[model samples]
Target: MRKFAMYGKFKAHPGKGEALAEILLEAAEQCKSVEGCDLYIINVSEDDPDTIWVTELWNDLEAHDASLRNEDAIAMIQRAKPLIAGVEPIKLKPLGGKGF
Candidate 1:
């Protein structure tokens, strides 16, 4: 099966950047144990403190979907909704990469 990749950009509510980042970081750690989760990285934008990005690579679409059903992951997502002002997800078809 082909791997799945997603690049997500999150904008935090005014003055809520740090809080949003903390939640995302914790969620990333929790996701590390999920099956088929190849990579889950959290990044903060230096240019815009309120902008956060998550780069994820999964073994397949099923694995990525299953991760969302996790209790901890579900909880984290709910908690983050209030702090997030906006979110955008960009799907990627990774042909080749050093990390892979």
Candidate 2:
């Protein structure tokens, strides 16, 4: 079965990118331990200090759906809630190996 990937881009509070990145790093690690989580990573923008990108790959849709019910998943979102200005989450259905 093909996997699914989620890409998230969020604008955090001014001057709080590093702090938020620290928090997100923990969250990403937390997500990695989840059952269906293939990978989770936090990427910071070089030019923009307030922007961050999160990449998540799930084994399947069921696992991705179940993640919403997991405590750590809930906590991750909650932890990021206060620090974010806006969140844009995009779900991707893998067509092949690479996606631009």
Candidate 3:
């Protein structure tokens, strides 16, 4: 299966970083049960508390779509509406592994 990844800069509202992180982490856990989710993670910037990022891997584009349609995802996004300032993610398609 082809690997799909998403990398992004999520700017959080003032005093909402921790709360947004919580929702992201929760979604990560919830996504494991998703049909095609391989990996989901959230990373924070130590130098910038208002910044956060995510790395997600899915089996395919279809799976990625399903993950986005999941109830948990919808819920999480809703919960995060007030906590986020801006979300701009860049999606990637993996070409090959280390030996490629």
Candidate 4:
């Protein structure tokens, strides 16, 4: 089956980047207990302190979609919403990689 992946950037409001990243990290931990979740990574760059990058890998598109509706996931989203200024998401089809 083809894996589903998403590379997204979350722009935090003003100086809320670190706070937003922390929330996302919590979400990453929550994903560990979710079925079909392969990876959920939170990243930051010194060059962009107000931006948080997230990488997610799922068993398939359906699994990814279901995860969005997961209770923990929904709570995390709510917590992060106030800090988020904008979001940019890039969908990808995983072919091959070290993590794959």
Stretch of 10 with least lDDT, candidate 1: 91-100
What is the per-residue lDDT of model 3 for residues 1-100, given as tens digits with 9 covering 90 to 100?
A: 6777777678999878888888899988888777777677899988888888887777887888887787778988899889999999898986767622
Worst 10 residues of 2 by lDDT: 91-100
**TM, every model:** 0.95, 0.82, 0.87, 0.94
Residue runs of model 4 more than 4 Å from their true location after superposition: none
| Lowest-sum lDDT 10-residue window in model 3 | 91-100
lDDT value, residue 43 of candidate 4: 95
Q: Can you give the lDDT of residue 49 in candidate 2? A: 88
| Candidate 2: C-alpha RMSD after superposition | 2.5
The Cα RMSD in angstroms, rounded to one decimal, for candidate 4 relative to the true structure is 1.0
In angstroms, the error of model 4 at 43 is: 0.2
Candidate 4 per-residue lDDT over residues 45-77, each given as its tens digit: 668899898998999999999888888888889
CA lDDT, every model vs. true structure? 0.91, 0.82, 0.82, 0.91
lDDT of 2 at 75: 78
User: What lDDT tens digits, residue by residue, belong to model 1 across residues 13-65?
Assistant: 98888899999999988887788988899998989989999999998989999
Candidate 3: which stretches are off by over 4 Å? Answer: 98-100
Root-mean-square deviation per candidate = 0.9, 2.5, 2.2, 1.0
Error of 1 at 84 (Å): 0.4
